[model samples]
Target: MADKKIWQELCSMVHPGHVFQDEPLGKYTFTKTGGKADFLVFPESFEEVQKTVQYAVANDIPYTILGNGSNLIIKDGGIRGIVLILTKLTKISLQGSEITAQSGAAIIDVSRYALKAKLTGLEFACGIPGSVGGALYMNAGAYGGEIKDVLSRAVVLTKTGQLKHLEKEDLYFHYRKSSIAENGEIVLEGVFSLEPGDVQKIKARMDELTFLRESKQPLEYPSCGSVFKRPPGYFAGKLIQDSGLQGTQIGGVQVSTKHAGFMVNVGGGTATDYMNLIKHVQKTVKQKFGVDLETEVKIIGEDLKKQES
Candidate 1:
């Protein structure tokens, strides 16, 4: 637990309305399951983010940057220290063939904005459910397109609260990972370079991809998207399906029947339930196919019961 004095100091750094203590994380994450955070702050501006981060570092407090809470699993024990949410920092603008988006702007909204502007390169991201920062952090991709392909440059806030612009080459994006994630830099905004295209054609492509996602994925249930990364020369979903693990249930979580790659929360699922189900799938897939499944979703936070012990 954080020192009471430090908490008070943090509360003083931001508006009372923007700072929350012991906030339930389940209410914010996509899976709708997790523990409470000691502090959750929604910063409306980049400067506010910088101030909060600087204070945390100076005071020797732990902190985590959250973006839309997609593709994440927080343990039932919740998170320690401060959790900074950038959701309120959403802003997007288009200039010529370049699109600039604040870190908190939803990727889907950005894709739609591109479509409205008759931009072509962002069609593949129309169905991605993460924010710009999250997408950049993980090099998020779909339908054979990834963020690295369109992003020209990004403004990042370093651990020491220094702002730096990293070009696409500096980002070093690869298979759902990026340098920003490795360096723990906070993405402030990004500029995407796209080409002119017919608006109707762009919309048609987005609609098609959206339909494909809804058709193949379990849209009805809560999940952290794909549970595992695809192994070399093999598809994770195909392997799980072939292993007959589809629809397998443990507690309230189950292997998605619609798509074997996803483990869904049917109802009242806990993070432990999700973790157990993940292990089961991994073991089953390995035994049947001799391929180890690596997780794509990020799992964090302490286990509450274990911490109490």
Candidate 2:
């Protein structure tokens, strides 16, 4: 049910066009499987964000901030409250040796910006799909480098709505995880110090990573990137492949034969299909090698649909 008061408040506080109802979140997500969000608010400025946040808080309504939806899976039942997509908040600029990017700006765009500036360190992220905010929140990495290697600081909004700057050390970034995710902190922007190098050289390195990723990954299918974290002493994909789980299907989702790390929706797949396939793979792998695998993708909301069935 729509809260009349909240509607009036949103209309008063935000641009009328920016507030959307029953927004189809699937289109926004890389997986293309989620249901509609109750409300999707796209704020153009920090003030709009603050207003939306204050309203949700004061009214005791739940809210979750979402980035570009690159590495996320929203459930079939979908999220109940408001989802604030920071994608519209994209802003990028350079100052001297430092570059600042708004949370919603694509990390790849930031990398490209740095490359144009002849800044070399962010090249590892040139092929990453998530926004800068999500990248920093998750300490996203590819190949050997990670956000911690170049990130100097970030501005974040606390769960309580207070803004503060956190240093790289304060962010507590580790492989595929960070303090922001652990503490439920909302990233607003980030500043990274990149050393200048030959733009041509930077482009060449980025091109190589891009080529390698595309050569192996199933870019055609909608997926939540790598399905599992690298298990110790072995690559997750290799283990799954060794277990002979390739092209395995539960409902419409299948383990990619090309790259066992991905669980792809072969077409007409739902979240239940994807999850069931994940469980099946886990069971088979554990049964085969006595090695328990861990998922890297974050699964939110209830998994009841799979359970009830």
Candidate 3:
């Protein structure tokens, strides 16, 4: 009853169409899985976002951020409270060697825009499948390049509801992570420092990386890119493959035979299936090599209702 009241209040605050009830979670995730969300809130700008967050916080409603639904799993039973998606707020632009972007803009779009502007540093993100904010929050990287190499600063909304600009050092970007994980600061926008380059050469690099991604990844299927973080000495995929976990299936989810790093949904897989497979892989890998694997994918939402004692 309380949850429904909060949902109704939120709807009244935003446009009617922007707030949805019992929204199917399957349509939003990269893996094309999950059950449902209590409510999904679409806020189109910073002001809208602030209002929504303030309301949620004031009313003691749980809220979680959504970024293109990439590299995430929202559980089988769905999320409580509201899922805040800023995707509609996307914007991108450039000035000299600097690129400015709203948090909602696709990182790949930002990378491509930089390339078209004859900028070199962001070509590495041409194949990244998340939004600019998501990439920065994870310090997302591949092929020896990372967001740290290009990010100058970010406009962030702190947990206490203050907006501030944070420099690169403040973000504390490191291997596969950032302080955003610790502080829960929501990214609003960012600027990247780049350099002018030859268009032909930039295109050549982007083309080559695109080829590598297309030819190697099982993009034909739906899945989170890499299931586990690199385990220091050995690659996650290599470890999974060496453990004989490749081509393994639970429900419709299969550990990619092409790239052991990914767990693809060849058909209609649920978050439950994905979670079971992950557990199986982790147990097996731990037994075989005495090493515990940590997931790179962010898993959230409640699997069971909170019961009173």
Per-model TM-score, in order, reads 0.97, 0.95, 0.96
Model 3 has how many clashing residue pairs? Answer: 0
List model 3 lDDT by residue over 122-144, tens digit each.
Answer: 88999999998889889999877
Model 1 Cα shift for residue 198 (angstroms) = 0.8
Which is the winner by lDDT between candidate 1 and candidate 2? 1
Candidate 2 RMSD computed on C-alpha atoms after optimal superposition onto the true structure = 2.0
Candidate with the larger TM-score of 1 and 3: 1
- Candidate that would win on lDDT: 1
- Alpha-carbon local distance difference test for all models: 0.92, 0.86, 0.87
| Candidate rank order under lDDT | 1, 3, 2
Task: Write candidate 2's Cα lDDT for 143-256 as tens digits.
Answer: 988999999999998876777889888988878889999998888999999998998899999999999999999988888888898888989899999999999988878899
Clashing pairs in 1: 77-304
Query: Candidate 2, 227: how far from true, in Å?
Result: 1.4
Q: Name the lDDT of candidate 3.
A: 0.87
Q: lDDT of candidate 2 vs native?
A: 0.86
